[model samples]
Target: MSAIEVLAPGLLTTVQDLGREGFGPMGVSPSGAADPLALRMGNRLVGNAEGAATLEMTLLGGTFLFREGGIGALTGSDFGANLDGTAVPRWASFEVKPGQTLRLGPTRSGARCYLCVQGGIAVKSFLGSASTHLLSGLGGHEGRALRKGDVLKIGDAREAKEKGTDHNASSTEGAHKSNRLRSVAAKALELLAPRKVLRVTPGPQSDWFPKAAQRIFYSSTYRVSEEANRMGLRLAGPAIREGAHGEMISEGVSLGAIQVAAGGLPILLFVEQQTTGGYAKMANVISADFSSLGQLRPRDEIRFELVNFESARKLFIEQEKLLAAKDLIV
Candidate 1:
């Protein structure tokens, strides 16, 4: 079996997939790739399933030694990666010969980067997922961030290939596959670009705030604070006045819920957020803008645009249509 040995683990590197769903009722949050779009694109580029487990690196990147030659792709933010001293481009596929070392530096564009290989990371799954739930420490490789000297098993490349096409496919089919890969890579570069304005819809408790507070929430600019993490992001901005409505029982909170704390600061719930909270939610980020959350870095400036629930649904549908289009990859 082929494997990759970690030489220098970055700030926080973990093995993650799309994450475990339908388990929130059991006190488990979906702790998958922070940037799901990037992971999907990287996996597609390497001819693996979109949800295949891959290495997720935050802020700083690390060095690794590949024990066997294989195909790989670096997606998400630009991390200034290099293979054997040669610069490797992001959002494209490349090959790593046996014994070659790939090194990556601090992120340049976003908060995280993903390294997807021909075969996804092979780790025992928990609750039907290979995602690392940092808070509970119950999934992924040993249920925690990776460290130096850790060796990760690579799934069988033949299986990944079978998931796409037969190894003995006709030359025409092979050519088509090659063209589709390039086209998808080109489209990913455009679709995944970061933006400063996040689209959101009124939260369940939107009516609790006064009209004046509502106006301030949409008009003001917020900066990602140092307290940001996968579980949530504490924004530093003009304090939003506390809602007049009295405290209520704790309820289920969805990802991207903008909850206002007593200090007037808003906390944006993320992929690994707690299932239930009592904070008054001012708004919920639309699904289309979830990827944007992954790109936000500490101290980064951001604003919000209010949209209706219907519009949010339309936006999500459109994005899914574009991503699933056969022409993009065929």
Candidate 2:
């Protein structure tokens, strides 16, 4: 099988699938797509499974050379995508021929870009997934970012056909680099707009915070610090005042758990967060918008809206059904 050739490696591009399942008990984070919806949609565009192994490109993804003909769909962050020197429409299905080079330069909108090819990337897994958990050093191409000269064997190129409509694959403005994903309406909007609000529900330890902290939590706009990454997002804002029990015995912390440290700063846990955390959890981001939380940039402002668990679950299921697994591209 002819694999993708890493000609100019992006800042940090790695092979990731849906993520590792059933391993959180052992403290393995499901380190897969930063924007899972985009990943899954892209996979569907290429007639791949929802959790097929794809490339997770960072803020500035590098270039690659596809040696054979296949359907390639790019989602998540639009890092100035170009399908062989011409502008590649995003949010819509596009095709790449063998020997063509796909370029993803710096991003103009979100933080990560997910590239899904036909079929899926053929990489061995450590724990039933192709996602790479860098902290635990599991999955992906040796659990690290891709470098020049690395070759990734892909699944059958011919069978990797796109499954959806490419409705939003047209060009948009301010696309020096863009992340124009296919909206429900199939519009190609630029991703450089204002950072979006991230809704959340009060945490298991939300009561640990004082009244002052709770009030500030919902009202104030918090900025994501540069210290943020796949594991957690460190925010800069008014320190979240906590109760006397600064640190509790470690307990399971689900994805999107927001823990406030001793100094009062809040951190939103992501796919790579530890199974257990001692810091007081100020809030829990709903799974529905977990991918949006992963897209925050440095200095991006995000406000939280409180929702009940039942409401959150409903929103999650509704969102899941919004886009079907079939014919994701136009």
Candidate 3:
């Protein structure tokens, strides 16, 4: 079996996939890739299954040494990646040689980056998922961020060769063929700007807040607080006016739930959010823009735009089509 030796663990590198589903009832958050779309795309570029485990790097990237030759690709944020001192392109697959070192520096644009190997990371699964849920210390490499001297087992790259074409060919050859399509897809990912306008719909407890609170939520620009994390994004903006009956029974919370805490500030629940929350939810982010939220950094400004359920569904469909298009892959 092949392995990757960690020379330096980035800010918050972890092994993740599509996330653990059907375990929320057990109080296990669907801890997975903050940017699922990027993780899937990276896996696709390397000819791996969409749900294959990949390394999720936070703002800063780490260095690693491949003990065996294999194929790998980087997606999401461009973190000035270089393989053996040679600058490599993002959103494209490249080959790695035995004993070669791959290094990634600080991020230039986005908040997170996904590094996918040809055969995915081979980690023990919990709750049928290999994702690392930090809060609960469940799944993935002992459920913690990778540390120095950690050795991660990787699947056999030859297994991918049996699937027709060699997706892990040299970068020059692969780049020449799919440069244009990759460029288009890469551009779409880059459109997630520092200041973004996210689409949202009324939450289950939308009526719990006063009308003034709703107006402020939709109209005000909120800054992503420095305290934000994978579990939720804390926003700093105008205080929302809660109704006299502010207290409510704890209820189930879903991804993208905009829960208003006691301080009147809103916190957007994310992949690692608790199964249930006591805060009153005023709105929910549309599924189509979850990727946008994933790329947000602390202090980034954001505004919410209201949309109907039907429109949200249509947008989600369009997003799926864009990611699943055959032309996007080589």
Candidate 3 — what's its lDDT?
A: 0.80
Per-residue lDDT tens digits for candidate 2, residues 1-330, read 767899988887888877876777777877878887777667655555566788988888888999875667787766888977899866565667789999889998888888887668888877877788887777898888899999988876334333112322222211212222332135212222223777788898888778887988888888999988888889999777655266788898999998888878788898888888888888899988887876777788888888998999987776655554222233
Q: Ten-residue segment with the worst summed lDDT in candidate 2?
A: 170-179
Model 2 global lDDT (CA atoms, 0 to 1): 0.74
* Model 1: per-residue Cα lDDT over 181-237, one tens digit each: 332436645875777899999999999899889988999999999988889999999
Ranking by TM-score: 1, 3, 2
Q: Highest lDDT: which candidate?
A: 1
lDDT of 3 by residue, 8-41 (tens): 9999999998887787678888888888878777
| Cα lDDT for residue 97, candidate 1 | 91
What is the descending lDDT order?
1, 3, 2
Report residue 279 deviation for candidate 1 (angstroms).
0.7
Better of 1 and 2 by TM-score: 1
TM-score of each: 0.92, 0.88, 0.90
Q: If candidate 2 were superposed on the true structure by all CA atoms, what would the RMSD be? A: 6.3
How many clashing residue pairs, candidate 1? Answer: 0
